[model samples]
Target chain A: MMDSLAAVLYLILFPGFVFLLVFGLFCEWVDRKVYARLQNRVGPPLFQPFADLIKLLGKEDIIPKNVDSILFQYTPLIAFAAVMTPIIFIPIWSATALFPLQGDLIIALYLLSIPALALFVIGWSSVSLYPLLGGFRAATMLFGYEVPFILACLSCGIIAGSWRISDITAYLEMYPASMLIVIPGFVIALLALEAKLERTPFDIPQAETEIVGGVLTEYSGKKLAVMRLMDDIRMVVGSSLIAAVFLGGFIVSYGSISWAGTDLTNVINFLLYIAKSLMIVFLLAVIRTLFARIRIDQMLDFSWKYLAMGGIFQLFIAVMYIGILHG
Target chain B: MDLLKWARMKSPWICHFNTGGCNACDIEVVAVLTPRFDVERFGVLLKGSPRHADVLVVTGPVTQQSEARLKRVYEQMAEPKFVLAVGVCTCSGGVFHGCYNARGGVDTVIPVDVYIGGCPPRPSEIIDGVVHVLNKIAGGGLAEKSSVNEGQAVQ
Candidate 1:
């Protein structure tokens, strides 16, 4: 009972809602700052994301009369909860997570899709023209990206010989040098993740110029704030997943600086995990800054033709490396 | 001030609405968002949805057809909304002041807090106008001032 209670507290407080929220907002700050710098503009202050959230929360909540009241009100919260669940399964500062289970990687992948699904529902339930169109676009984009993303993740699982994320990290730690061979698959997966996050070059679903905020056109106040936070949390999840799968999750010390205490090493590992996640976010921001939004058809075509092919090719190479070369 | 109020003042997302004037003021407003002026330094983002915006930046003179649209957009915005009427046209219809279809300024449709006067105000002036709206928000005068013109639409 005590252990269960502790787990619940941990889920709600430390590595779950509060921690992910703060970390996600920080990552958002880094993203915006880097984007601004790249464009030769001064960005908002470090507290900008936090301020935006607070302001949104303080605004009056408006529910359009024509909308389905129940779904419209609850979808953002559900989406947020869905995104927060995976953080508990991801090993941030240790080899094992708060709730590590065999074959959790598949579950994590499934959980990541819920937010996009929720977005589609939000768009459809709003009973508005722009949002309905946005919803259809979002669903189409989801299909376009999910295949390549799954294939890329499948490659990582094949290389590590385990469907569990902790096992994958353990395998990587056992043979640290194998990361070089995994880089190609990781790059393919990273690009897919960028599309999944709906950044520039693949932001057709939320194309502001074309659809007036797209699926988020009708959302306001607390709901909008929740949705924005969900996006940031998705960023955290994507970058952390990349860090764990490619960058050797939380194994910061390779005998360079030997700390006398395990506690100190743990602290260092935690900080290193944060740094690795931030680095991935910085890379994503650079991609966002350099590229313009692509047309919906163009995005779909690129995802289906180029990314899918690249993912398969990388997966084949990983299979060869792990099956024959490494063996 | 309270943290919520401080946050509201710090991050004011503006939604630009072109009621119906020449494209000059709209261009100037967009310029303010570019690297040169960068209104984002003050956490002022050009939001695509009025639902997510704190300040409604209305450019162009209010046309007969857009008067209802302007009112609807203002109504669509969540509470504590401020309107910044950019350019003389948006302030009082400028060159199109007495034209057949002109409906005067944005003030004719929705209450405006700040008026930026120019044929097309420079990006600097637009930024200044936004800062002034921030000042109004910080002073706690937004509510009382907006209430004065509540439900009073121009004929």
Candidate 2:
């Protein structure tokens, strides 16, 4: 009974909803701060994302008469729920996930894609000209990024000889030297993840200047808050997933010194996870800061021509490395 | 309530709309977003859509053609929205006053909360206007007046 109770608390609190929300906002703050500093401007405070969300929640939610009311109302909630599930599969404070499965890697990847799909759905349902265009653009951009992202992730799984994320991390821990083989895949994954995030350079789907808010043009108040939070949470999930699959997961040692009824190793591993994820966020911010928004065709061409090829190259390298290792 | 108020004050994403005038005021408004007078520190993002905006920054005089569009834009913004009429043109038509196409200030079409009086207000002045709105938001009095936005246009 106590075990079940602890599990419930674990799922709802730590390494779960609350943690994801706070950490996601923190990552957003770091991204904004870095982006602002790069432009030689003062950035927002740590509480900016939270404040924006809260403020948005307090404002009026206007559902346009022209919109497909049902889909428009439910899309943000659907996207938020979709983005939330993937983080649970990620190994956070430990080397293993809370509920490790044989093919959780693929499951998590597919779950992440749902948010983008949700965006497309909402855009179409908005029935406005900009949103229709935005929806089409989002669907088009997904094809450009998703293939390379999936291939890059699969290459890491290939090296580990397992489809499980924890197993891949375990493999990396076992052969720390083999980290070199995954570097190309990791870079490709990072770039593809950036595209998936719909940030600058790949933000053609919601290019503010060109198409207003694009997919998010008609969203306002509580729904808009939820969507913004969804994006922020998606960033956290994507970065942590990358950190786990590529950066040897969290380095948790067996020495469990219980301090104040909590394992010291858990705390150490949590901080390590945070640090690694923040590093990814920082890199993303730099990319966001340096690049201008690229045209949709350019993004598509670049992703297929360069990122996909790079992912294929990484897959080849991983296969060769594994063959040498067993021989 | 305090937290809600604080959030509302801190994060005021503005959407800029030009009713009709020369593009000088628009240029100055854009300058406020640049590094020289960054308003982002206060969580002010210059949004593109009125739907995503908490504050509407109106530039230029209300021209005959833009009056309907201006009203539509203002109505599109979610509630708890504030409008800052930037430049003398937006405040009271400036040099464009009595022109056949110009219909006077933004308030002639839609209710305006704050008025920045300059032919083309400097970025510093624009930032000052935003700060004034933020301060009013802090007091919790301005939001209540949004619905009754008549003869309440504070200069």
**Which is the leading candidate under DockQ?**
1
Give residue A177's lDDT in candidate 2 (0 to 100). 79
Chain A alone, TM-score per model: 0.96, 0.96
lDDT minimum window of 10 residues, candidate 1 chain A: A253-262
**How does model 2 score by TM-score?**
0.96
Provide the clashing-pair count of each candidate structure.
0, 0
Q: What value does the lDDT take at residue A83 in candidate 1?
A: 86
CAPRI verdict (incorrect, acceptable, medium, high) for model 2:
high
DockQ of each: 0.88, 0.86
Q: Runs in model 2 with CA error above 4 Å? A: A253-263, B143-155
| TM agreement with the true structure for every prediction | 0.95, 0.96
